[model samples]
Target: METTGTRRSLAWLVGIWALTRVVLLLFVFKVYAFPGPDVTSDVSVIYQGWYEVLRTGTFPLDDVTWQYPPAAALAILSPALVFWLDYTSAFFVLCFAADLVVLLLLLYAGLRSGRTSRGAWVWVVGVPLLGPTVYARYDVMVTGVAVAALLAGARYPRVMGALTAFGAMLKVWPVLLLVAARRRGSWVWAALTAGVLAALFALAMPGAFAFLTFQRDRGTEVESLGALVFHVARQYGWDGQVLLNYGSVEFLGPYVDVVSTAALVLSGLAFGWLLVWRLRARSFHVHTLADGAFVAVLMFVTTSRVISPQYMVWLVGLAAVCLCFRESRMGVPVGLVLVASFVTVLEFPVWFSHVVASDGLGVTLLFLRNGLLILAALLAARELWRSTVPLPTPPPVPTESPRLRETSLPS
Candidate 1:
């Protein structure tokens, strides 16, 4: 009965949160205004356009901005099934459903673990705090895939691999989850991931590889951590231009390429650190994989050249999973991630103009958000390292031989 009551309480919280998001969508943000500057509006236009292409049996449309793998087309065109609703409405509904799926998975995982409701609370508080941006971006869908993969990872390697592969097709980041799998499980996951990815690429043909070329010419997004360097440089007479490139705020002109390259180098270093962490983890506990995943994702996001507002959805989901374990000592780091999520909303739809202008408030907000992320990454890494590194067992005490024991016994 207590378990039932807890479940009911969780259900009420989730239902209320979902309702608030819907209200925000209809009244506050009006995200269904397709083709507008709001990110989701652009996403809806692109998805609807892609749906038309799919209807014509084409793999990818000719738009250079369509910079995702072929499997993404499945998600992009999925809203077409709701014939009664327009594309914009259908896309919002789909994203909302995906958000709820993630919440359900987190809650179920927490209950199954027989741990405190920390994980469910993380999702419950974190997602809504991120505001409407969670629904406005399809990152929520990718996050759902990630949640399922991690929750199923220990018991079901193949399923984890397949889901990770599906997510990688949508966005490249989900592949990081494979790092947490055991050696044998990792191989199985890797094989299935590669096989599925290859099959999807084969089906899409030439268009499947187009995003690679499209991504090559990309500049540093103005809101990225790297852009903050350039933003500071601008005050010291650095010459550069900020513009909407490829549907994101990007820095162009002198030294932009150099900063972008430097971001890549930093990302490489972060990857190396993750590899070291994986090697040092001698034993895999129930929560080890989830904790490792959270650290890996935090490293990836903090060091990337593109730190979009929606990226918080990924961190929020992963952090929730980490907190599901009773042994996970990541409370401080998870709290930091939640704070960063709130700041992300402030940096985006709230004072995005200030950010674009590189004003004092904007720069400060970015600094706080990015700094919190970096701190969270470091703390999570430390926690995982301490938790996973096996302690040396003391040598067993030598026992007396049987004859010696008999001779020594009181007679």
Candidate 2:
């Protein structure tokens, strides 16, 4: 049951994780790098907006304000109260430490689902940390919720639903899982998600529902694949206004409408594919959710006119969530995501500049990094499609959950 090497490996892993914590603390505290790095990145601005929100009970109303979903604004503001330090410093480190929360949640989800073996959960921890992208966005927040939701899918549907709903409010993807998913496969899951979301929304504001109305009026940035057409328009010297001030950017080209149409068509197809996948996928495999999420992010990144660096965090976070489940099952895909994460960081900070500088090798590596992510997504999808490993039944919580096996599907 227990071997000396296994014990030694566990000890070493714990030591390395502890070291990671210390190093991250150093990075946050000014020992590993600059003392006062300029707040120039988009994430910095986002944090600034959150800080402002916490300082005063206001969320961004327009592009000038960094308008995010009301629920998300609250989520972002949450850490401010938790850490109680200077916003920037605390924001940076707490976000980093959130990954640790993810790890604990990963284990908790597995344990509740009768998935306590080292093989079942170790990869989730080992692989994501290896990825350089681990340092990226707050996707870990969403992952923590999504995985917890999935793990609760079998026995505690309402609680699962509440988590998923809360995640959807944070970012739109979790909602897709909630709405696009089979209604009865996990009604308790859906109910819980919906309840959690409703509760959060109720607490956010009486007018919080109104904030959701303004998103369609918002702007899309140059980060998406949609920006490619904007670039071509500039190349042709078209003189239409590129973007409007409030939220959405408006670009002009002879084929601008056509490209928009194409983007919609492609995105719709991708969405449709996921819908079909939901229909076919019966297994509650965590990789199933992770693989699908990766595909969704890939579709968005490739087809989106705005691919913000923070977006990578979303995919990476979900990938890490999947790894938690994977380690309990298989190990390889976790390794792939981990490698992709490193390549992602390597390519982004330094390599992105090189590609823009017209270095063909830089472009090659760029594609390579993206390719690794694609490969990882495909690999995980294959396993999800092939492996019908049913979701583990959750034991009862003092709070009741939606029943799993009794769920029925839409015809």
Candidate 3:
């Protein structure tokens, strides 16, 4: 039976979430009437354009902004299931459905664990705190797949692998979840599933490999952590110019290439750190796996040259999954993530003009947001390390031999 506190908490969460969504949707509708040129574009135009291309039996490989993997084609086509409705309405409805699915899965997992309700609380509070970006972009769908994979990882490794593979097709990041599997067979299952999916898509799509080339040529997005360095440097008379490229604000000018290359190097270092952690880890509990996955993803996002506002959805989803385990002691880190996400909304839609100008308030917001992420990343890494490193077994107490016992016995 649910406690009174749980009931009250649930009510509050649902109420707040609903109110936020309504406000965000209203804002989105107003903007759709007078769309502006932004990184995300008008949701209706982007989704409807892709849907039209898919309806013609052709992938959107020719579109330069269509940088997602072919598995994303399904999500693009999903809104069409309600074709009777207009594109914007159907797409928003579809995204809302995906959001609910994630909430249900997190709640079910929390209850089934027979432990604390921290997991459900994280999802209830965290997703909405991310603001409208949660529904505006398709990253929420990928987050759902990742959450499902984490839930099924220990009990059904193959299923977990398949889900992760499907998510990776939508966005390359979900593939990182495969590292959380405990069983050796889980690796094979994951690899096999991913490989098969890749092969199938390659056969079906005309330009299946196009995204790779597109991704390679991309520059450093203006919102990334690395970009903050340039933002600061601009005050010192840096000559870099910010422009829209690859569907994001990017710094293009002298030494921009150098900064981009440094971001890649940091990513490589993060990957190496994960590898080292994996090899040294002695504990493999579900909670530990969730925590590890969160750390890995945090590292990936912080180090990447493009930390989009919607990317917070990925971290929020994984952080909620981490809290599902009673053993997870990530309350502080998760709180930091929540604050960072709220800051992200402010930096984007609220004060975006200041951000573009790299003004004092905008730089300060980015600093706080990025600083919180860095702190969260460090704290999560520390927690995972301490938990996974097995406690040393004390030397076995020396046992007295039977002969010694016999000799010592009273005659």
Q: For residues 1-411, what per-residue lDDT tens digits would candidate 2 score against the true structure? A: 456765665567556666766665564454665222221233456656655754565454443444445566655675566566665565556556666666666555544543433422343344333333334245556656665665565456566667777777776666544532343645565566556666766685544444555544444343345544454455556565454434333454366656666767767876776666677666654345445555565555545544544555555455545454523332455566556555554545445544333245544555665566557556655555566435567997774346643464344
Residue 209's lDDT within candidate 3 is: 64
**Candidate 1 lDDT (Cα, 0 to 1):** 0.81
* lDDT of all predictions: 0.81, 0.53, 0.81
Residue ranges of candidate 3 with Cα displaced over 4 Å:
31-40, 391-411
lDDT of 1 by residue, 231-287 (tens): 788778887888978767898889888988999998999999888878878867888
Name the runs in model 1 displaced over 4 angstroms.
1-8, 27-37, 59-61, 391-411
lDDT of 2: 0.53
Best by TM-score: 3
lDDT of 3 by residue, 147-201 (tens): 9999888678878878888888899998888665677666777788878878987
All candidates in order of TM-score, best leading: 3, 1, 2
Question: What TM-score against the true fold does each predicted structure earn?
Answer: 0.89, 0.70, 0.90
Deviation from native of the Cα of residue 147 in model 3, angstroms: 0.8
